[model samples]
Target: MSGIPDNLVGLHKHVKQFREKNDETLFEELELFIEEEKVRRKLVLERPGELFFFYKEDYIVVTEELSKIPLTAEEFTGSSSLLRQLNEDQIDMVGQLTKELVILRSMRMWGSYLSC
Candidate 1:
């Protein structure tokens, strides 16, 4: 009842090779993390330092490493020491604080006009 070709002897060989050679647990964990990241980005406007995001007024600059900007998830995960410096949570907090600074700057600008 199987739909695979009867003559295909090596069809599953590659899969077995991959499973045997690769760290399946780590791969699965990374896969799940990727899925969660996708969902989080979909539900939210921003994803912290994952992207080149920042508030302009505070002169905040948030950008990923040049090498990682173009890499796929598989490539990023495979490479060691590629993204050791960037902290998503810390970057997100900095971005938020920058936005607040921008708001404060605009308020001061208008407040001066009202006072005059």
Candidate 2:
């Protein structure tokens, strides 16, 4: 997780290959990494229920409701809008951020399987 994003892609490819080859050592290593990642994520995402500013259920509900809201140009910058304003470097950075976010969401959804 401390490495550059490109390094992460390489690590992912390596891990995928290890799984394809049915390597037990790789499985153990990956399980350890997953456990460490779970603890790290829990530390960041978990908070006291009494913390009014950071209620987990409220955040989830808010995001769900927000997703249903229709986007307008004045209120939001959609992908098409971004394409017109972003420089090549900015676009690249945005793409990288989007990729990272997708990976994070997928990991969050399937983390239980990773531990097994």
TM-score of each: 0.22, 0.25
Q: Rate the local accuracy (lDDT) of all candidates.
A: 0.38, 0.40
Writing each residue's lDDT as its tens digit, candidate 1 over 5-102 gives 55645544646545643555645755665565555445334555443322221123344453234333344563232222223223222223322233
lDDT of 2 by residue, 1-116 (tens): 44224333445464543565455565576677666566545645674321111121122212333433433344445444443333332433322322133243455433432232
Residue 67 in model 2: lDDT: 36
Candidate 1 matches the true fold with a TM-score of 0.22
Instruction: Identify the runs in model 1 with alpha carbons over 4 angstroms from their true place.
Output: 1-22, 46-116
lDDT of 1: 0.38
Which residue pairs in candidate 2 have backbone atoms (N, alpha carbon, C) closer than 3 angstroms, thus clashing? none
